[model samples]
Target: MIKQIPVLDCCTLSGYKEDELLVDHLADYLHKHSSLAFPHRHNFYHMVLFTSGGGAHAIDFTRFEVRPMHMYFMVPGQVHTWEFEGEVNGYVINFSREFFQSLLLRPDFLNGFSFLNGIAQDGAFQVPAHMEEEMTAFFERIYEQVNRVKPLQKDLVSVMLLYVFMRMEQQLSPAEKHKFPVYNYTLLRNFQKLIEQHFTNLRLPKDYADLLYITPNHLNALCKEYLGMQAGEVIRNRILLEAKRLLVSQDMTISEISDELSFNDNSYFTKFFKKLVGMTPEEFRKNKA
Candidate 1:
């Protein structure tokens, strides 16, 4: 049996209050809605700042320790669950992709952010102590604007959100800033978009290369140069992530998961998973349990 995970819509989850965006105090939001304790997927983007807390947050297949002065980012389709000790206080912001694209006039605008672009090794990080107050203030302003009945509401939210991202960009060191050149960034974005579309059926580098109008070698070289990994690793990692999600979050049998992922057979999927994860699917599922 596959345990069904809830796919939450931003507007509905936020009480259908402010259209496609929701900004609120984390503790207050949790207080009102207790069901968030369960693992869930959001159809929109999610970012939360932790002013105080100690716990664990699992994003995809990795569990990250929670700490103060930290931020976690989650793009659509990623599975996440969290447990915090004592009083966890901070701000939570959620917005849909359509909402962002409408305001920015660019469908792939989020590719520029390391957090959303899969360029960040882990989706959570600790903010420098000196920047905590400033980050909090930005979230506060966004919360206020979100709740206010004002003209040009969407534009106002977009400006405030862009300010936050801009401030984050400014904090990046010169080396980090130059990590991805403009052309490479475009390739990365296209590659990621293609993966989301075809990861289920197409797992080969040549297949993706054909889609991107590049030769397989060129695609592999670009991925290695920018992401520090071959294109195949990127594809395998994504499939592995989804496999883990199904194994742990859902109650699917190993054979069922293998079939669902379109593997040649159960044995091939098991071998492939163990090679990368250092454990068979059954072992991984047992460990999670």
Candidate 2:
């Protein structure tokens, strides 16, 4: 039997049966939810604006250092865990996919923000020194808004969060923004989403390109331009990430993990893991331990 890592949802964190959003101070949330400081996944969008802290956290196997005025975002299904040095305090918001539907006209308003688009590297950033005052106030407002009892409170909170996103988006350089046009970002993000779903069954770039209705060359070009890797490499990276994720389960042996990831055989899987990772699966697991 496999002992799966925990997947936390809004209800589990807020203790509200029908809650779709959670807004709280980081210190308070951490105090009540310290048990979740292990490897886990969140079922909703999660973001944190750190005002003060030291240490590190991992999102989708990538470790990021925790520091003052830094923020990070996580989309649903990404695995993350927190490790703080001491007395971390900031703001955290977790909202469902539908949290903005009733308040916004565009169904895809949230997708326009690069920081919230589900990539681990793109989502974490340090708040600029000039914007720190305004940025921190936005989070404080969100913390206060959630405590108020009023009509359309969720809608109001949604708008405030949108403002926060807008200001943060301004901090990104024009070169970064111009590199990924809307059409290209849509295709690239969709391709990644498909890989998340079909990586085990479909390992080729052409397979994903066909589904996205673009030529294989075009797919690879977009990936190279934006992600600095070929489309196939992106797919393989997702597969490798899942392999690492599965290895987190001690009950699952290397053979079982290989089978779970739909590799043809244990030996091939071992070779694949070692080639890209520079270590055997067992070695990677033991090292992480």
Give the number of the best model, judged by TM-score: 2
User: Whose lDDT is greatest here?
Assistant: 2
Q: On residues 117-188, what C-alpha lDDT tens digit does candidate 2 reach at each position? A: 667898888888999998888788888778655443777888898888888787773336676686887898
lDDT per residue for candidate 1 within 62-174, as digits (tens), equals: 77877877888888878788878888889988888777776677777776766776433445777777798889888888888777655547887888898887677666522
CA lDDT of every candidate? 0.80, 0.84
How much is the lDDT of residue 121 in candidate 1?
45
Tell me model 1's lDDT, rounded to 2 decimals.
0.80
